[model samples]
Target: MERRSHIYGVMGEFATPEQLTHAVEKVREAGYRRLDAYAPFPVEGLSQALGLKRNLVPLITLLGGLAGGVGGFGFQYWVAAITYPMNIGGRPLNSWPAFIPVTFELTILGASLAAVFGMLALNKLPQPHHPVFNVHRFSHASADRFFLCIEARDPKFHLADTARLLQSLHAHHVSEVSDD
Candidate 1:
């Protein structure tokens, strides 16, 4: 019925981490949630500024590690007690003590793998392209510039108001990002 462009968001380029952080706080205070920041290096308290807490990766890792430990122990128990039922002189059929090492190792391995995968999934990695890439200045995001993007998907996002807000925040430049 109607054509709509795949506009991802409006981005603001900042000269310093403090400026970006202040802009982020202001945006957050202005009730914009679907936003992100990019910078040349890690900036302390950035996550706090963005109101990010309770990351799920650690929980994923814990559950995966527990599953691995249980699976490993159960496999060993099955092999010793159900499948083969090997018995040495006065030794128990299910030697749980010996199984602990393998179980622990598998637990660590599973946790590590889960951490990696969970982080990837959380960050939505393997994405070949993103709208932010359309900006010529965005390349400097990996160098000395700091960038903040307020996504169109955000319920609070209005093109004119968002651009105005970015300008009020003293952004060096404000540009729209297209999904294409």
Candidate 2:
């Protein structure tokens, strides 16, 4: 049996957003996946460089709202007609008009709950740790500095070769992004 060596991601630091964006494109063209760019402010071409498709947040929100509406309608119908029925002034036992307000409120409530939970889950919130945090210079990510990190998890990742590739991309500085 043979053992494989672990390879981690490489981090390229940049002084300007332009350099970061350009380097990102070079990285993508170099045929690397599992890379992410970070900057204090959003850049125009950053998302395209990272090859991110549309976010699933909206889809989750929509599904949640649909479920909420259906649940609201079903619950009201069951309670009014099946659970307990009453006749007032010979009116129909299933009083649709009076139940409308409750149904509407419940729909809104359920949708709101779904939106909150869905957003959190989609964003993978409560993640207090990340390998990028190990880089002391990463704090600058929230400042004026911009960076692109190529994760070792990529299929083509090779430790020295990846670092060399970033260097060839004219990155200001390249360093290993480590989890340890």
Candidate 3:
């Protein structure tokens, strides 16, 4: 079949989370990988059904925190020992204990900022529009409806076969999403 360039994918709206989850599992079993589900609230075990991997936010946060801590401590050491060395009461110029509080605060700050930014970046936030919004019924996704979309970009996606699969899974409505 000839692929349509303007077609985003085929979307199936389901009545409940259960049906959506089941459809997702069935679609995955049928070898379709590029698919997404939407619901008003979080659905348990939906990630596993979608075959999602572990999140990378924690690792990003750790790296940010380490950078902040190291940078803070290094700055303090540079000022105290190299840039402006002070010898007061025969005390050493490099004071490690005095830098602990600032280092700790900077670490916390960096970790929180990293988490916020990482989450936004990973989720692709600030998106004012998406191809799914072109469907009139998709507005219900924020209310009570659940939806599953099989993207046209998926290697196994064929408009007719995907629509049939969604219909066979007892979808309330199946429609084609347009990229335009």
Candidate with maximal lDDT? 3
Preferred candidate (lDDT higher): 2 or 3? 3
How well does candidate 3 match the true structure in TM-score terms? 0.92
For model 3, residues 73-130, the per-residue Cα lDDT tens digits are 9999999999999989989888799989999999998888899999999999989999
Better of 1 and 3 by lDDT: 3
Total clashing pairs in model 1: 0
Error of 1 at 25 (Å): 0.5
Ranking 1 against 2 by TM-score, winner: 1
The lDDT of model 3 is: 0.94
lDDT of 1 by residue, 1-180 (tens): 111368888999999999999999999999999999999999988899999898999999998898889988998999988999866896888878899999999999889999999999999998888889999999999999999999998888888889999999999999988879
Ranking by TM-score: 3, 1, 2
Clashes of each: 0, 0, 0
Best by TM-score: 3
Cα distance off (Å), candidate 3, residue 32: 0.9
The regions of model 3 sitting more than 4 angstroms off are: none
Ranking by lDDT: 3, 1, 2
Q: Report the alpha-carbon TM-score of model 1 versus the true structure.
A: 0.90
Which parts of model 2 have CA positions greater than 4 angstroms off?
1-7, 168-170
- Against the true structure, what is every candidate's RMSD? 2.4, 3.1, 1.6
